[model samples]
Target: MVKHTKKAVLLTLLTVNMIVVSACSTANTSNQSSAAPTNDAKATAGATGEKVTLTYGGWKLDTITEVIKAFQASHPNIEVKAENTPYKQYFTKLETSAQGGTMPDVLLMNGPNFIKYADNGMLKDITGNIKADQLDLNNFPASLVSLYSLNGKNYGIPKDYDTIGLWYNKKLFDEKGVAYPDASWDWNKLVEAAKKLTDTSKGIYGFAAPMMNQEDYYNTILQAGGNVISDDHKKSGYDQPEAIEGLKFLTDLIQVHKVSPTLAQMTETAPADMFTSGKLAMYFDGSWAAFTINQNQDMKNNADVAVLPKGKKQGVVIHGLGNVISANTKHPKEAWEFVKFLASKEAAEIAAKQGGAIPAYKGSETAWLSAFPQYHAKAFIDMTAYASPYPVSKNTSVWNTYETDILKNAWTGEKSVADAAKELGAKMNQALAAEK
Candidate 1:
């Protein structure tokens, strides 16, 4: 899940108070913006004692700490030393270490960041170690595990998944005297809802756009029967008339519909906060926001989740976390043990209990649903019926680097949706070609 801790708490307990809990995967975030971590923080301390410390690196220090403690308690031989870095720089840091051959033993990997490490051969292929019978393969959802595999090699274990949904503010809709969205929602209904719900007098917006990949634009693109990338993961499809049409629907909400906040405004103000504060009627956010929104006092009883508005097709992006080991590691065998334990049903179960996130294991969703039953948190499971994989990219950075800035112009009135998408298609093809 999204990782944030109010403060650090150290438990000096003598023994593990095993609570039959599940292990949850944590999300790594960036704090240094574009800069790398300080030299001291990245310094490797080799073999500090008789105890074998398997250096682990992640952005989510809290989640990693918990998992490492629990694992160390059981396996006294291995001590997992976790280093937390911001998400943006983690890969950059890893790349630097990889060149110097000092990469951590265990690491966290994500899809958008995958192509770089996997393509560079910096990641260890654990497909054989994670075979169905040996690891808790049955605990994982097929869709999640498949995200980490390339050319028959598995780089990581499935951690958790997050998917997009329609988060609406009942307070805003109720005040506007408009009905909230449901299964029958269509583009027309969304437009009508936005128009009715928007009240400029109250300093409230109808919606907000953050120029995101999965939950924001891509999800809308798929709902309109358009693919961001072609099925084979080759060629860019943004130039397609269908894709442009799909995009216009969201951008139009601000440029034409005038019911949503513009790109400039959203850049200054976070959209989720605006929604939780009852400034927006609806937000296209992931199930991960269930806790973030519900925790807000203003939105606790006011917010609810629902299926996304449908276009010609029904779609939602299914994104998951994976456990990746480094190619250059001092403890390959011990790292494999950690990977196997991480891939177990028991680990996923502990995570669920700790509000870790929606477990990659199929049936483990019930605990995540239990984590926030009041917000109808089962929306993750329900949305899965219509979920689509995040459009894959072999050279992901080629597209990701240019995506936000290119799409932002369309999101504002600066570029027409069709025109901008056509230009993006050409640039995307160039990006795809550059990799070869």
Candidate 2:
């Protein structure tokens, strides 16, 4: 849920010089590309006599910029300009803008980071803006929308959602004489397939066990019947027997099983890159990675997805962000109108069809699936039945950053799992206490 596709997307958008953003739009927000106009366009002022110019901050500058331009087309009186920047730096920009007292009129807030901004009184309460009275709350997925709400107040609009699944190279399975992955597959089956597929002589491995919070590690945690964060979001369960055993699976792959490359080797050659280049046979990734995998010519033809092997409970990770209007927006009404329009059923459908991410609105992903046929993306559909939101707490960012780093060190064998878990638990408990 760390937007695993982002690094892959950015890598392509910057290095490959492809991943062309074909601007497409409806009567409302779209990805249509056009030159920004210097002149202000406005429709007749609704209740206020003033025309307004709105600014937005989002990592998807190209996509959002197009939507804003088209927004001006429909509401000719309101002009919206967006500053697009790299996803890695968008939060720093948001914080800097917040400090300057001029944060964008509409700010982007992901699930994990939203609690910090909303709880600190940096956001406007938009519960009234999005009324179950006006719109059907049923259109959006429950888990995704709930992630943006805290204590009955909605601070962000759920834009898109994605879940994790196992991506396999079909060619590898064929060469190894192993059956394709399916729901019947379990942990032992996966470990056995991994062993059969791994061949150091051929320089191919079965899995990539990078210690990321989401893709590999979180799935492992859930598979071991453990929660990454406690229900109350206080203290650390990182040291729990199940959680440590979950993490040990990865270390087992490298140190005990000798299938995956050591953590050092994985660091030098990132897992995503390795999987895309055919060096690895399988990977756990989000639906968004379809864009990157499909765009990569080498693996594009051979890649496919399957439901991940089950643990005590079948699990998948869901993640997305909500559209939030600034607490101090001069045109709060217009901003809300725009937010509703972007989050509307039509808008979500267009977003799904556009090939960027899956829309959280009900029934939108059907179109997204049709748009890409070769991958047989239904594993994602199957995942929705049991998917869980990425866990977040008051100080989620603080705790996870430390916990994941220590876990990574543990995976690489720099420290023992027991020792690392205790250290991680102590730091996480301290972070949670400070949040309290």
Candidate 3:
């Protein structure tokens, strides 16, 4: 899920504080314009056995520590230093590093921020490298490949992908005598089950309706046959009736159905915390959350996953992270070699076995599903049949900020769904216009 408020603020800071290199700029953007590394550059890099140290930046470095160790073992000529930062402060720190011309040689790029960096000539156009190496783009999901691409040029290689699913507690369902959610379940069934399962007296809510985007409202919006942005990526869809209907679905759970905790209540205790603590009977989360959810001993035997209940139709949001090389890197060839390994089947297999996230590599999901036998983990992959890419644009954070601020009104009942969504559409349109 996109943490709209914090990330949006950092993105704005990045655009303001860092030097914005034009896509066509020749001064500091030579890396961006270069089609491929010169043969001499490659000869002096890892291929020639020259020792090189490259900084790799990302949040949650612990998750890929094993992968990094494996890369170092295979490529003894290159040493990768891990620069770990919390996700909350990741972009802020990246911006600071970019300003100092100390950006990591290789870094993680999420869908929302990928275009921004590419547009500013901060990321190397890896199209030439990919073609030179004959790395099959077909090895990953098309959505992810496109996510990190701009104008027929690829800038990043997918590391992994995540899709949303409905996570529920079997113990709670059994106690309430509610049947487990399944593929056939729809909006009405979810509401009925939630009503039966809710027990305010016991401080347990039947469902979690937090003010979240990717994990909550975004899926609902898509399920209602609505969209967050237009197909052309130039307009907002929030003002559409279908979009309003989707937002209303979640708000009604809190306001009309009273089966969910209010936004304020959820603020006091995060819905994920509630789920792990057995206070929330049902919640929606991403496939990346599998490890964290299973970490709770109490939930190990009590929880399982299912496809999200359909609204007007079945839908879910799909997103992934990619490994991008910095345009200012001193070791372009070495960085590409490391990035190649990161996107290779070996790395994907390690990721699957280690269980940080679902590997985006085509044929590696079986290992991931086998990694966790406690829950029906396949439900995460199953939803990909109807999953839509998480909405993005060059300035996704600007409109995301508008979404976070404006949608709070509807979630709080301060404004009607129609009013909040309509207002948000107008604000988002202004931001979209500025992108031009």
TM-score of each: 0.83, 0.85, 0.89
Where model 1 places Cα greater than 4 Å from the true spot, the runs are: 1-51, 136-138, 392-394
Q: How good is model 1 by TM-score?
A: 0.83
Preferred candidate (TM-score higher): 2 or 3: 3
State the weakest 10-residue window (summed lDDT) of model 2: 20-29
Q: After superposition, how far is residue 317 of candidate 3 from its true place, in Å?
A: 1.0
158-227 per-residue lDDT for model 1 (tens digits): 8788888888988788887889788789878988888888888987877775677777888888889888
Find the 10 residues in a row with the least total lDDT in model 1.
Answer: 6-15
Those runs of model 3 whose alpha carbons end farther than 4 Å from true positions after fitting are 1-47
lDDT tens digits, residue span 1-436, model 2: 3343432332232222111111000000011012111111223253465677777777775644445555678887677777677776666656555544566767667777677666655566778656742766667777777778888888877887777888999999999899889889887788899999998898999987777677777777788888777766675778898878777877888888888888888889988898998999987887878888988989998899898887666766677767887665555667776787778777776666555577777777887888669987878766767777778776566776686678777887889887898798889888888775
Encode model 3's per-residue lDDT on 1-436: one tens digit a residue: 2344434444454656332110000113322235334442655556666789989998777888889999999989999999998787777777776655678889987877777778766788889889989999998878778888998899999888888888999999999899999999999999999999999999999998988998988889999999999866799999999999999999999999999999999999998899999999998988867878878799978999999999889988889889999876768888988999999999989877776678889888888888678889899887776778778877887888888899999999999999999999999999888876
For model 3, what is the error of residue 408's alpha carbon versus the real structure, in angstroms, after optimal superposition?
1.4
Clashing residue pairs in all predictions, respectively, total 11, 9, 0
From the highest TM-score down, the ranking of the candidates is: 3, 2, 1
Model 2 segments beyond 4 Å from truth?
1-46, 64-66
- Residue 286, candidate 2: alpha-carbon lDDT: 78
